[model samples]
Structures are given as structure tokens and as C-alpha cells.
Target: MAAPLSTRPVTMVSPFVAGGTNDLLCRLLAENMGKSLGTTFVVDNRAGANGNIGTAFVAKQPPDGQTLLMGNSATHGTNPTLYPNQPFDALKDFAPVCMVAAVPVVLAVSTELGINSVADLIAYAKKNPGKLAFGSSGIGGSGHLCGEIFKTATKLDMVHVPYKGDVPAIQEVMGGQLALAFVGVGPATVGIKSGKVKALAVASSRRASTLPDVHTVEEAGYKGVEVTQWYGLFARSGSPKDMLDRMSAAAKEALAKEEVREKMLTQSIEPTYLPADELNVFYRNEIKRFREVIQRLNIKVT
Candidate 1:
């Protein structure tokens, strides 16, 4: 975390465009934090490089408590393995503030594929071999990992395609440019609702509230493959303990608010308000899990 500083405006950077869940949550937390602390907490949009642009910017910011990083899965969990030469360290360069929520990924297929369930997809893949193709947001995103995990679990020989962002990947699947994809439920839900895509399963342990009809990967016969896109807050390493404590407390309070809880629930994001100690434990386990997956897949990002 950043070093202690006198009471000054805190500049919070979100690594996504406005209207996304990350952007929305950051704004909400900033507004609430500002109110609670009786000081301004400004949110700046630094969208690019699949969240790395803003995250790296915050990592290199002054080690004072004035700058905060609203980090998500792309920056924390996925980027570590995806970018072999990433300039900043997700764990070392940043002090853990709090874990905001877990965003689940949905396994969806185009309606034209005539696949309604995971079993159906697996059966078809078995028969078709390398004919089927799956797309994801990028090479090392939760969506990409989900598809790779599915391929390994089902012993399918389909191809993997990576796109720059979730919207384009999901849209391609909807437009028949691809057969299927695993995407964040927020964007996938729209296509599913429109009847353009069919939901097979989710990569979470339990079913998503947004799509109760869909089953979990375990239910689809792939156990121990649960993965969720998570979001959290961080500051430069060595940030004052008092400032970290204050931010963590404010985050916990904001997450516990009835309105915040309900809104997150509506978006199918499970709230996880973790203090520093517990958050570190969670991050360690996630890093380990990512390492195993990368080794198993022999994945190396350029």
C-alpha cells in the first residue's frame, strides 16, 4: 500500500469504461468513501490494455495514500500468467485493500449449434473432433481458462480463439462467427436473454441468480473447475496501515449496505468483504491455482 500522507483528495483509478460492473462499483465505493471520510474520493477512468493500462499506472504512482487502484481479474489473477513480462507485480507492488466481489463466467453456445447442454456439446465435440471452435475475451482471461478447462476435462479436440474483449467475443458467438464461448455472465446474459445464445453451464460452484436455468460445471460433470472473475482494491506497497485500515473498513461497510448488496446480487456478483489477512490467503490460493492451470495447459503468453 502507499505511504501515509496528509488529508488530501484520493484519486481512485478504474481500469474499465464507465457502465461496466467494475466502473459502477468503483464509483459507488468512491461516493460512499467520500461521504464516510468527509473528503473527496475521485474516480478516474483509465481504460485500455484489458485493464493493464490503469493498473500499471496505479502501480507506478506515488507510494502515498492519495492514489488507489481498483483492480479486477484481468489485472490481478489472469494478467500474471497471460503476460510473461508484465512490468508490475500484482501481489508485491500493490497492498491489498479489500476483495469486492466474485464475477461468474457463463458457458454459452450459439443457437444454430443445436447444443442445449454441456453433455450435448461434449457429445458433438467427440463426434466432430477439430471442427468446433470456441472463443474467449483473450488468451488468459477467465473465459479463456474456462474454455481450456472444459476442453481438457471433456477431452475435446476443438480449437480455441481469443478476442480482445468480452463484447466482441460474445457478439461473434451470437453472430455465428463462433460456435461457443465462456464469458462474464453480465454480457452473456444479454445474448441469452435475446435468444441468440444458449446457456449450457456456469463456471461457478452454484448456479447464477441471473440465469437460474443454467447449471454449474460440476453439475455438467466437470467438478473442481470452478473459476470466478474477481475484483478488488489496492494501493502501492508500503502504504500506511492506518490508511489501508480506513479504506478496508469503508469498503466492508459499503459492501454490507443493503442497497449495494442487492445491486451486486442482481448482477449475480457474490460479495466478499475480506480484510487484509484473509484477502492475502485468498490471493495466494488463487495464484497457486493459476500456476497449476498454466502448467497443465503449457500456456505462455507472448
Candidate 2:
């Protein structure tokens, strides 16, 4: 049995702006976990610096489990390599509490382009050469990484445009400002359903439930181009093991609810709950994996 959690109200810090994937997941988890744990979990949006500002804030908090962070791929995975001079160390400054969800990136294009599939996109890019441009939520974001992976695998010359968020990037694609965008299915699902944008491929090994008709990149013959962005919980380093264990239990319990599962699926997130120890391994592997990919690709942010 797990020990008692802090009686104080817990705050789940979201390092990104409201209305984003992280924010949505944070609110969802906060509400569900609050009910399961019988404690208040408030979502605090502290957006800026590509998630560093808020993450740095949380890193300095006390080692008690009262304050939690909703960390995602950018803050914990690619940022370590892309922004090496951050005030907080991704690994040393915080401890993994639990992994909440995983979202597959999608290839969204403007419906005006008449492109129907990944093959069509490749052929168009080949004909246009450097004329094509793709947008992402930001540089080093999962969307950008997926675009880079796709470009490298297919040997295409599509320029990258960074946007403030996926919605804006998809808006650009809808307006034909960008040929396509590699974005999370959560934000892209609405546009795809409305005919404002079309999804050519899901950048995962398997098809996304949100867009089951869209084939995976591997299915489109671009094997090994699989990419995903995951969201998880974190607390300051050196937090008590029992506290972490109780927190993990509450999270897993909330995740086990079928209503929660359905809601998460509707948002294009897979309810992937991992305990603290397992999340530690998962987080470390992600950082290491992304580091290798960033270094080999010679990706830099200036």
C-alpha cells in the first residue's frame, strides 16, 4: 500500500501556454487525479521560453510532492541538446513522477494542395525542390523532428517554418502559406475533419486512432521515420519515494477510468501510464535517444 500524500493542494505546472496539448493533458490529469487522490490539483499555466521558463520555476521548488510539473518531449527530451545552457538540468533538477500520455505527430497539409498521400507529397517536393516549406509548432518540437526525419528519409528539400503553436501552423497550412505541417493529431484532428486540412501520414509505427484511415509513415514506405511526443508528470529531485509512489498510484488509478481513456482518445492522446521507476527509465532513454538524433542531424537553435 502507498503512504499518504501531502495534504496541501497540489499545483500541476504547465510549461506551455493554455489551449495547447500539454495544457489540455494537464487539466485532464489534474481533474481526474484530484478526484482519485482526494486532493485538489490545480493547473498553473506558466508559459514562455519554449517551456524553460516554467520548467526552471518548478526545478527550484521544494523537494516535496506538493508542486508537480507537466513535462513533455520538448522540455525533457530535445531541449537538453538544443538549449544546452539552460539554468536547470533536465535529469538532475527534477525526478520523473509518472508518464501520462503519448501523442503521435501527423503530417497535415492544406486541402488546397490536392495532395492525397505521402507519395504525392514526395513527388511534389521532388518536382518543386526547394520550393516546398513545412511548418511546425517550433524548432526542436516533435513536429520539427518528425519533419526532419521525413525529409532525411525521403531526401527532400522542404524548408522549415516555426510557429508559436500547432494551431497557427495548421492555419498557415490551411492558408497555403506552408505546404504542410507536422503536428500532433489533437490539434490537427478538427481541421482534418472540417476539410480545412488533410492528413497524409501519421509519423508513428501504427495508425493513430484519431485518424485511422491515414496510414503510418512506415506504411507509406518511409520505414524508421516513426516519431512521437509524450507528456508526463515531474517533481523536484530528491522527493520521497513513498510520495512519488502514492502520486504514481493516483495517476494510474485515474488513467484506468474508462471515461478518462475515452476522453484522452478523443483528444488524440493514448493513455500511457507508467510508474515512477519505469518513467525514470523512459525519460532517460528519451533524452539519450533525442540527443543522438539531434547531434547526428547537426540540428542547432540560434
Please give the CA lDDT of all the candidate structures. Answer: 0.83, 0.87
Best by lDDT: 2
Off by over 4 Å in 2: 1-4, 296-302
Q: Model 2, 1-302: lDDT tens per residue? A: 33235578899999999987789888888888777677888999999888899999999999988889999888988889998998899999898999998899999998888899889988888888899999998878889888988888899999989998788999888777777999999778877877879999998878887788999999999887877888899999987877777778888888889998898898789888888788889788878977877898788876
Per-model TM values vs. the true structure: 0.88, 0.90
- Reference-based TM-score, model 1: 0.88
Give me candidate 2's TM-score against the actual structure.
0.90
Worst 10 residues of 2 by lDDT: 1-10
**lDDT tens digits, residues 132-165, model 1?**
9988887777888888877878888978899987
Q: Runs in model 1 with CA error above 4 Å?
A: 1-6, 262-268, 295-302
Backbone collisions counted per model: 5, 0
